[model samples]
Target: MNEKEALILKLIKEDPFISHFDLAAKADLPGDRVAGYISSLMKQGKIVGRAYVLPEQRQVLCVGGANIDRKIWSKGVLELGTSNPAESSKSCGGVARNIAENLGRLGSGVSVLTAVGEDHEGHWLMEYTRAFADVAPSEILKGHSTGTYTAVLDQEGEMTVALAEMSLYDSITPEFIDRKWSYFASSDFIMLDTNFPADVLNRIIERCRKENIQLCITPVSSPKAKKLPHDLLGVTWLIANKDEAEAISGIKIETEGDFFRAAETIIHKGVEKVVISRGDKGLIYFTEKGEAGVLIPPAISIIDVTGAGDSLVAGIIYAHLNRIQTEDACKIGMACSILTLQSIETVNPILNNQQLLETFKQNFK
Candidate 1:
C-alpha cells in the first residue's frame, strides 16, 4: 500500500460513509486520483461492495503469513518407509491469517497483512480469506508460488510429519510494514506472528510501544518463537503454546509450577501479560498485577488441531475488545479452541458471536 492509498484507507476507516469528494478533499488529492485509489483498494480486496462499504476500520491488524495447508491422514496403521492409503484435505492456514479469519467471523473488524505470490494459488488464497477478513498483502511476488504447509497425520489426529514452504513471507519486511504504519494509528489492537524476521519483530514491538498501541503476539512455532526479541516492552499480551513458551522463556516446562514461572520470566522480559497454552492440559496465565490462574479445558473428541491455537488467540482478542474479565476471556479462548479442534477446517465457518457464547456457556459455565 502506498502513502496515498494508505491515507484513503484511513479516511474510509474513520468514516466508511465518507463521499469520494469529501475523501479527496480531506486527503488533499485530486478527485480522479481518489477514485483511482478506491478502485485499487477494491481490487486488492481491501475495499468490498459498492458505495465504499467495508468492515469497520480494521480495529485489529494481524500481521504475519497467509498460506495454503495440505493435510493427508492415514486411515490405518502408518508405514513411514512404504506407501500407505490416506485421505487428503486442504484449507487456508497461517497463524495471522487463521486468527484474522476467526476474528472476522466473530464479528470483529480485522485486517490481515502478509505476503503472497502472484500466481493462481495466491489469488485463490486472497479471495477466500477476503470472505472473512480484509486482505492487505504486503507484496505479491510475480514468479513465486504461494507459501504452503503439507502435513502427514496419523488416524489418531496427531501430526506425524510436516513440511513448510513459506519463503514468500520474506517479502513482508520491516520496510513494507513501515509503509502501512499509518494503519496502526486507528487499530485498537495489533497482533503479530513470529514468521516475521527478527528485525521486523523488534521494529513493530518498538513502534507499538512508542505509539502506545496495545499489542498482542502469537508465535507460529518453537523455532520462530525463539526469534522474538528479548525486549518485549511494548507487548501487551503474549499467547504461546507450550513449546513456544518454553522456547521464549528458556525454561524447561515439566511440572505445573513451571508454567507460571515461565510466564513470569516472559513478563520480566517486558510483556504485560503471558499465557502458556499447555494443549490438553489447558492453559496457565499471568497478569501484570501479579495475578495468576490456570484453566483446564473440558475433555472432548477432536477432529483436527491444525488451527486451534490461532482460534484461541482470536477468542481472547475478541474478549479483550469487549472488556471481558481475564479469566473468563481465557475460558472463551478455550471454548473457541474446543470448537476449532472439532472442525476439519482451519477456521471454523460456523463460529459467530452467539455460537461462541453458546459454546462458552455449554462448556465453561
Candidate 2:
C-alpha cells in the first residue's frame, strides 16, 4: 500500500475495464509503472478480486464443459470391491457448467458456450439448462455423445473412484469460438475451462486479452488438466486445487513455502494470478509480488463435496465483480463451498442478495 499502489488500485476498482493507459494516467504514473503497481496491489489484496463488476442485471458468458454426473453413496468407507451403493443419483457435474448454473441462481444472466451430443442425455441436459439459464445452443456441437462422469462415494460422502468423459468438447475449435466470441462481447465476464483443446483455449484467451475481456478458467480435472498449454497463462485467472497445481506446474506443494515457490514458478511462466483451493485446508492465492491464504472453518456436516469447487469459483468471481476486495471474494467463495458441501447439489442454498448476506451473518455469528 504505497501511495502510488493505493492510487493505482483506486483507479482499477473504479473501473476494472479501463485501459492500462487510462489507468496509468489516472494514477499519475508511467504506464508500465502503473501496471506494475496494479499487479503488486492485486497480490497484496489491495486491488484484489475480479477485473470487472457489472451491473447486477448484466450477462456472464461461461464457455467450457458440461456433463452429467452419476454418483453412488454408501454408509461407511465404501470399498471398491463388489459395488452396490446404498443410494445413487445423477446431477450436472462439469466445473464450468456448475459455476454457470450457480451464477444464474445467484441472479446473474448466464450463457453457456459448450458442446453436447444430440442424444437423449444431451436433450435432457439442454432442457434442464434452458429452464435455469440462457444457453447458446450454437456453441454446442451436436454429434458426439454428451460427456459424463461417474463417482463412487463412501458413507462419508467423499468420492473414491471417478471417471470423466469429455471427448464431445473436441469439436469446439477456434472457428467455433470466434463465431461465438461476439455473444460474449456484451458480457460482463467470460469463464472457461481446460476441457477445450489447447489451441482453442489459447485462442479464446488471446481474444479475451486483446479485447480487455475478463477471463477466468477452472482446470476441470487434475490428470486431464496436465496438458494445459503454458502460453495460455497471463490471459486467464487460473483456478485449481493443490494436486492440479502440482500437475500443471510440475511442482509439489506441501507447505506455504512450497505453495509460494510453485505459484512463482507458474507466474513466471506467464500466469497473472493463481487461485488454489485446498479442500478442507482452505485456499491460497498468489500473484507475481505476493500471496494470501485462508482456512475453511470446519463444516457442520458434510453431505456431498461434488460441486463445492465450482460453487467456490462462482462465489469468488461474483463477489469480486460486485466490488468486493479479493480477500473478501475468497471468504465469499469459502461460504459458497461450505453451503454446497452441506447440500446434495452443486449450487448454493441461498438465493438473492438478502439471503446470501443472511447466510454469511448466521455462519459467522
Candidate 3:
C-alpha cells in the first residue's frame, strides 16, 4: 500500500466508525481525496462496507492499580489488637480493574493500563483482568511484587480497616503511559484511580486535555486520594466516596450543607462534575454548571461492600457513553452499587445491562 493508504488503514484500525470527514481532518487531506482512498481500499478488499460493520463499542481505558485482594471477614465483634475468628478469601480486586470488569459486563469495550509483577499473583491478576477487558502485554510489568490489599470487614460487611501494598504501580511512569498513548487517544473515555503516581496522573491529564478526551477519576481511598493533583483541569468527572472527597477537598462532611460545599470545592478545582458516594445514604453530586442534587438509593440487604464504589464509577461511565441523561445516570450508578453491595464477590458476576436497567426501574420509577 502507498503511504496515504497505510495511514488511512491505521486510522481506521484505531476507530472503525471514524467518519470520512474526521479521517480527512486527521490525515490533512481534502475530503474528496480521503473518499477516493477509502473507495480504492474497499475495492481492494482491504476495507469492508458499513453494512457489515458492527455497532461501534465505546471504548474506555482504565489506568491504575490491579492487585490481589485478601478479605478477612470477622464472624463476630472483633478486637483490633488481637486475633479473632474470621473467614478469609482471595480475589482479584483493584479500583481500575473492578471498574473495567464492571464496564465489560455492561458491554463497553474496556482496556486496562496497569502494572503487575512476575510472580504468581501477578500472573493471576493479568489473566483475571483480561477476562473482562483488553490488557496490553506491555501494561503488565515484571521484576516487582504484585500489589496486594488486605481488608478487614466487620460482621455487617462494612470495611473496618484496610492495608495496601501497591508500590509496584510506581513503575507506571509517564514514559510507560507514553508507550501506550494510542489507547488513550482512541478511547471514548478514560478512568484513572489515585493509586497511580502523581506525575503519571499529571502526564495523563495533560494528554487527555490536548486530545479533548473525557477523563474520569476514582479516588481509591482517603490517604491515596490526597495524591491527586490540586488542580483538576480537564477532568470530566471526579467520583469519590465521602471520605475521599473530604480528604481531597479538606472539607469536613458532617451535614447536608457540608456535602454540597465539598462537591463545590471539587468543581472549583476544574472538575466538570463531582460525585460523592455516601454508602447507605446514597449519592450527592454537583456539576460545574450549577446543577446539584442528591440521589437516595433504595435500601437493600447488604452482603459485602467490597467493590461498590468501583461499580458505581462503571455505571456512570456506561450511562454517559450511552447518552443517558445526567440525573438518570446517577440513578443507574446507584443501582450498580446496590447490586454490588448484595454480592460477596468484589464484582457481582451476574450484573449486566438488563439487570441494571431492571433494578433502576424497580427502584427509581
Candidate 4:
C-alpha cells in the first residue's frame, strides 16, 4: 500500500468510525485527497467491516427536552398588558430537539432521548421531530403534559418576552437515563441541554466520563443554565449564550476581555472547550489547551433569532465530530446560526450539509 493509504488504514483501525474529514485532519491532507486514498483502499479490499464502511452513519445521542413552541409575531409596536394584532404559529422545538433535528438534517444519524406528554401537543411534537430523528414511542411519556414555550416577538422578529411550561421534563429522571445507559455508552457523541433535571444531568455526565464518550452541553437558558455543575468535569464541549456563560462562570461579560475571561473560568472548571455566543457581535471561544479566538459572522438580515443558538451548537458538534479544526468549526457554527437567523422557523427546514458547506464557502472564502 502507498504511504498515505497505509496511514489511512492505521487511522481507521484506531477509530473505525472516524470520518474522512477527521482522517484528513489527522493526516494534514486535503479532505478530497483523503477521500481518494480511502476510495483506493476500499477498492483494494483494504477497508472492510460495517464500522469503517459508513462513517456518516455514526450516531449521536441527544438527551434533553422535547416540546412545542408557540410564537407570536406582532403586527405593530408592542403595548403592555394588552392584546395586539399578531401572527401566531406553533412548531416543534426545544433546545435538545432543535440540535438533534439540525444534526439529522446535516446527514448525521441522531437519536433523541426525551419525554413528551400524552396530549395533542406532545403527539405533534413526537411526529414532527421523528421526521428528522429516531425517537422511540417508549421514550416519550404517555400521561404527562408536553412541555410548551410561548414567546412574543417584536416587529424585528426578536423575542421580547417568553414563558415555558417545561415541568414535564421532570419525568426524565435519573432512573430513566440510567435505564438507557447501554445506548449512551455506545453512541459516538452525547449532547445534552440544561432542560433536564440537575440530577439526571449529573448521572449522564458521570456515565459519559466512565465510558470515555465525548459529551457536549448547551445551557438552554440563563436560569436552567445554573443546573450545570460548578466544576464541569467530563464535559468535552460547553456551548452557551452570553447570559448562560456568565451564570456558569460567575463572571459578568461586558467586553471582549471579559468574554475570554469567562470562557477561561469555565475551562478551568474542567471543560475541554468553551464557546460563548455573543449575538450580532459574534462568538468567542477558548480551549483548555490555550486555543482561543473570536469568530465574526458575515452580516445578514435577521428574520428571526429563535433557534439560532441551537443551530450553532449543532454546527459545532457536526464539525467537531468530523474532526475539523477548532477555528473552522466555529466558523461553520456561525454559518449555521446565520442560516437560522434568516428563517422565520425555529429550525430552518432547508438546513443541510450541502447548504452549510455552501454558506461556508461563500462567506469564509
Relative to the true structure, candidate 2 has a C-alpha RMSD (angstroms) of 10.6
Worst 10 residues of 1 by lDDT: 177-186
Cα lDDT listed for each candidate:
0.87, 0.73, 0.86, 0.86
Models ranked on lDDT: 1, 3, 4, 2
In lDDT terms, which candidate is top?
A: 1
Cα lDDT tens digits, model 3, 306-342, are 9998999999999988898778888899888888999
Task: Assess the local accuracy of residue 18 in candidate 1 as a C-alpha lDDT between 0 and 100.
Answer: 91
lDDT of 2 by residue, 1-365 (tens): 67887676566667778887787777777888876776555443244335633222236788887889898788665655575548888876677778877787777778787788888778777778775577753344556888998887877888887888878777777887765554656567888878888888888777777767788778888875676777655444677888888987889887877876776777777776678888877788786556566556555788888888888888877886787866677777777777788787757555455666666666644
lDDT, candidate 4, 327-359, per-residue tens:
999999989888999998999999998999999
For model 3, how big is the CA root-mean-square deviation?
6.6
Error of 3 at 185 (Å): 0.6
Model 4: weakest 10-residue lDDT segment is: 49-58
TM-score of each: 0.85, 0.79, 0.85, 0.83
RMSD (Å) per prediction: 5.9, 10.6, 6.6, 10.7
- Write down the TM-score for model 1: 0.85
Tell me model 2's lDDT, rounded to 2 decimals.
0.73
Span of 10 residues, lowest total lDDT, candidate 2:
48-57
lDDT of 4 at 261: 96
